[model samples]
Target: MGIKEFMISFIFTSILLSILFIPTLLTKSFAGIRPSSFSGHPQASPFPVSFAYLISASKGDLESLKRTLCALYHPANYYLLHLDLEASHEERLSLLKFVSAHPIFSQVGNVWIVEKSNLVTYRGPTMLANTLHAMAMLLKTCKWDWFINLSASDYPLVTQDDLIHAFSSLPRDLSFIQHSSHLGWKMNKRAKPIIIDPGLYNLKKSELMWVTKHRTVPTAFKLYTGSAWMVLSRSFAEFCVVGWDNLPRTLLLYYTNFISSPEGYFQTVICNSKDFKNTTVNHDLHYIAWDSPPKQHPISLGLKDYRRLILSFAPFARKFKKDDPVLDKIDREILRRNDGQFTYGGWCSERGESNATCTGFGRHENSGVLRPGAGSRRLKALIVKLLSMRNFKRKQCR
Candidate 1:
């Protein structure tokens, strides 16, 4: 090809690629979107509330996982960190030791490591199983107000104090889950297909196997599916894990062989149950954006998505690139955390060389120690909108 033609082609391709990818990072929150607030509440754990966190980490995620754990750490909360079996044994041991050696963790005694890890296939039922395992463990060990599921790639947009402060006013039965009843084309492609996940029985990582025959939708209940991540209430989690009702168990057995069970299992169980249906909040509380033709995986958040991410006012976002500069900005601005430091909160009382970023701790006694920042205001706005007259009951588990 001639030099002129090559240059022209290169320029056109560059422009097209830029156009395709740039807006994901550049867009701000949808225009004129202001949510109301119920912000006058006191800043205390209203009733000695505790949170159980199930944080899952996979291969090559040790550093980011550790960083995230530190940033999200709170003495009052219970944490169970699982290293996926796909990760090497050495890696798991390394993470275990890191958690064990931490002075604060040892003192608080709320952190636990999943000694026996489950094998996880990306986008498979095994991921759901792991979440259930952690839930069961938490139910057996301690009392908590809610169960929060997070991944190593995901980070908090607000401090734990801010989270606790906001949630203190909420009714204990509410579950934060983003869901939709519209199956669209997925009904034919995903719902009817029968696929066996090898991770259930095999030691090796492999793709889910599909059967030739398709099955009909269940007559017993409606199928609702949405984002896999959620913040489940403790009572509802117990209803799922150790319920007097048998449907949760029955559905568990049914979903054991289902593909992408994480997306559908909880939704199906909650929507099917008359007792829990009214308790659903129907918001995933995550800030995620997909491509024009949304793919099986959402796009990785990058530097450009900052404006929209902040404006969305969601407390958490997912699928960030490792060591992305956007994370640094979030740490500095939103979380008020320095690199490799804990996010600033009322519990962090000691001043470090730079600033008091959870350098030391003591039991925070004052009920009025809340110091909510701009992020808290943003999140409060979102919470109000989700709970407002227009949205509260209208869009739940439909």
Candidate 2:
């Protein structure tokens, strides 16, 4: 079946399923809210804001995924980890075991694994599907102000405390997405191509299959494209999933055959919708270096990129090699994280103590104690510049 027909069939099936499950969802009691163990050091931040994260990885990425999760973990945030279906059962099991065995993870109950993995083809609709799947799951399970998508290769330049503090003052509706209407070379290379991803249906992975026919650029709604990495507000995320206006659903079907749908799906949806277009911040909030003539992939960051990475003041950076020394340097200097431990945050440490180890929750009086350090200050500066009068409105959806 064609992409549009497939989407229609899937929607019909989903409607039926929703009909079957709606009563149960409404009547069934959710898992009991476990009281904060608050038995150890209180790891709560003073900031009220929380972020839900979707971290995606593929085969041979377990180690880097673990490290990235550790560096980004905070009691206040929610994390959903997706290991693509291309990974072996053994790897998935090992990852599951690791998450289950982590004491703090159990105590906090914020981390989750996408038990049924999706088969993801590079630059295909499956990548976008996996992201939306995680978003749906997170939306059902947690309360968060924003949703941020990262890959296994991405690591944080700032702690969760720093992030929370920086975002505390910002308007909740803003979405940090790098987008542009000018397709330039992409007009012919990407917009007109009709490619099918077998990963959407097949058990095994395969490259996107291009058809003999090409499609005209979409005119019903203007097409916008940009970095796949983004920070979306909770309201925007809900709009995409619920799709009250049908724009998100229509664009999803349209982008099914479009290459690198992840880069454009949300962009097109947000910009095309009058409610969200004005909220765009025009930045992906990631520090990444590409070669002079960029290749298929971005440059793998190492020690050489440290200064530039910090100076950029982005919350995250990507495409690092597993166990790179630069990661250790970041842990030591930027995050002050000990080996195999969560990043230092207010929830884990004492108020006045210097270099205090994060013992666990319950020791501090309030779970919302914030220990935003120099990183928070740096991030705040970046955010101020992004939202400034001269930069903010001028950069929206243009």
Candidate 3:
């Protein structure tokens, strides 16, 4: 939908929602929800904020995917898991079955798997297309304030309660995107090179093919590049998915031939738009550490980075080993999640008291329950610093 159409729709919905549930919308409470608030069912009383997560994984990543999903899962939130076409059919079926067999997932029915897998090349436009495809699906499916795209290798440092509580006081329009207009060396290598991903046309997976000819960077719209991970607002997600104006579509076409499109597509789109240029907080909300000199790809995080990780106070960290001991340490210390159980939250904390794991949620419905912890305090402090006057304005679209 276009911006005008979206505004009209949003106004109409808000009017009705405001009339029906004025108290809920006007709340600025970080004090977790209570059972006494709801009459009979808590489902009718939605959380203050929710996120839509797209977890993308490829071959040999089912276990990692499961662990990450469990850590990131929340009853109030929606999750869409995409397994690349490179994985076997049996593997995809296994993932679907795992989700279906899970007690919390089956009961809450908030998790979904992308049955129609797409061939995604590492740095090709297919990766960008896959992300957009998932975004379009989520935009049509559920209601969420923010859209976060993460890979299976990425893990959350804080509980979902911490994230939701920390963001409760902020404006919904703010998007956490690390971006800058300066391309530096990328101007010649990434922006000028032409590439064709065989994943687009071929049924099977293949490498990204390079073209001998190079084209000049377009003067119509300036290029921006940064971290591929982003915390996108629903408004921005809709604009990119629907192409309300020509900027999104024009950038899509331009970046089709560009290398590492994911790092630039959303950056270029958000910065070039007049409506969204100033609505950005210059951070990717991730604690990603690189090698001293930095290689072609980031180095995998291990136990050695634990102290620095906590100091960063970012909600998520990435490029971890599948079964890294650091993950276990983070689970025990930060997330409070057990080996195979979902993350510790008020939603299921009271349910599985016998084993003390968040296993079953159908017996006791506490989807509205949100108990923030010390991690919440850390996250809030970090966000406050990022949105401080000195950091917010100076780093935006620079």
Q: Which structure among the candidates has the greatest lDDT?
A: 2
Clash totals for all candidate models? 5, 15, 0
> Is candidate 2 or 3 superior in TM-score?
2
Candidate ranking (lDDT, best to worst): 2, 3, 1
Q: Write the per-residue lDDT of candidate 3 for residues 1-398, one digit (tens) a residue.
A: 34465345434423332231122322221111211223223236467888889999999999999999999988778788888989888888888778777765666667788767778888887788778777776776667889999999999999998998999899999999999899988899899977766676677877777766677888898899999999999999988876558687667767776789999989999998999989999899999988776656888999999999999989999989899999999998888888998787777766444333676553446457677888899999999999999999899888
Clashes of 3: 0
Whole-model lDDT, model 1: 0.74
lDDT (0 to 1) per candidate: 0.74, 0.81, 0.80
Candidates' RMSD to native: 14.7, 4.1, 9.8
Q: What is candidate 2's lDDT per residue for 1-398, written digit by digit as tens?
A: 46676556546533422332222232222122222443122234444788989998999999889989889988778778888888988988889888887788777677778777778889888788777777776776667899999999999999888999999888999999999999888889899987777776688988777766677986799999999999999999989877578787778777777899898989999999999999999999999888877666999999999999999999999889999999999999889887788788877787676583554654562647888998999989998999999999998888
Worst 10 residues of 2 by lDDT: 26-35
Give the TM-score (vs. native) of candidate 2.
0.90
What is the alpha-carbon lDDT for the whole of candidate 3?
0.80
How accurate locally is residue 266 in candidate 3, as Cα lDDT from 0 to 100?
95
